[model samples]
Target: MSVPVEVIFKRPEALRDRPTHYCPGCPHGIAHRLVAEALDDLGLRERAVGVAPVGCSVLAYNYFNCDFQEAAHGRAPALATGIKRGRPDTIVFTYQGDGDLASIGMAEIIHAANRGEKITVVFINNAIYGMTGGQMAPTTLVGQKTTTSPYGRDPEQIGWPIRMAELLSTLVAPVYVTRQALYTPQLVRKARKALHTAFRLQAEGKGFTFVELLSSCPTGWGMTPVEALEWGKEKMMAYFPLGEFKKPEAEEGGKK
Candidate 1:
């Protein structure tokens, strides 16, 4: 009895088949897959260029099957701007974390979005710093404990976590800005759609697309994989609500 089995899903050509170095249950892998799927769907893999800065995803170049440039901490947006401007035909993107982005890279990101650079940005905000030990980041929430803020983040002294999607949406030049998460299956599906939208807009030469993903860092958060997922869904989602903060307005072609 020879029965044939069909393959329903497979690895994206935009992603390498290498073993993952991410922690068990870390959402970085899921986020990677989503980005790869978007590139594959748009046939943009050949022209895609990714810029990765210091942080957990610093070694992102090793995982993705595309050209990657390494930039100094908080300088990804600046570097990406140059790359896109120089080679307007290529699809350039940056993969950054909260600490690398909202903290030191804050000015770089804001300015790039304001200028409407034709590039896509994938931001992974896990609240606390991930790669350089669990320290309080610009996106760390009040009462969240980290290595530096062992007593929990104090709003009086540290202030609140930055809502990047909302902040960037306020800018007039951006074509797309949205926040999504991977804590649940439904949310993960939505995140994939968001990624698709971001990449699709960039392919059409739309200026400045940003996708903020609420990622889970179990090791940094000091919780089991399951607990970290729950914390992201409950605490993180409450503060950084997921949805489109901005979208492209109708153009001459009736594109919205």
Candidate 2:
């Protein structure tokens, strides 16, 4: 008799039952799924420890099945540092949004990269703040309007969106840095690969892997999910070009 094949299309063992608390069309859920899938693919679900930040994903602990620690606003890297230092055997990672990572946590994120912490950071950049009533985030586009930037982001007052992947790549300590978007089917597949690569780098004990995902916030952006995805491709991608910023071998010979 021929052996039978089984197919499965269910939640990963590393994810929990609580449906995501994200608004409709928010890409946070997709990002969460990608992270969970990466953990499963690396066989590190049980050994993974996630540090949830204070933003849209603040309650990420309730969504992921692995052990989690809730960090204060902009303190996820600091907390993850402690966790990784204490339990070097555990695969530590942090999930943070643009407001949390590029704004209040900028120093922490930079220092962590400078120190070459053996951890992975998944950064969701949706342009504007998704939580707290759609305020302007550090990654908000120059022409984007939020509650705080009702008249659109004025470059005179507010600077341009921070290119996080490029900024981190300037540091020599990190081993991997990449920027990917999830606005289209092909981009989504690319994002999955980037997430998987980050997890793989962590598994290999490579230093400081960072993946910045260009996500969408439809509700906050005052558009349908489909429209927001289109905007990301037409506008967001122009400013934040996708691709790996830094890799281990590239830096080995002093090349960026």
lDDT to native, each model? 0.93, 0.91
* TM-score quality measure for candidate 1: 0.96
What does candidate 1's lDDT look like per residue over 1-256, in tens digits?
9899998999999999998778888999999999999999999999999998899999999999999999999999999999999999999999999989999999999999999999999999999888888999999989999999999999999888899999999999998998999999999999998899899999999889999999889999999999999999999999999888888766322235
TM-score of 2: 0.94
RMSD of 2: 2.6
What residue runs in model 1 are displaced by over 4 Å at the alpha carbon? 251-256
Tell me the tens digit of each residue's lDDT in model 2 across 1-256. Answer: 9899786688887888787878888888888999999999889999999999988899999999999999988889999999999999999999999989999999999999999999999999998877797899998999799999999999899778899999999998998899999998899998998889888888888889999999988988999999999999989999999998888773433243
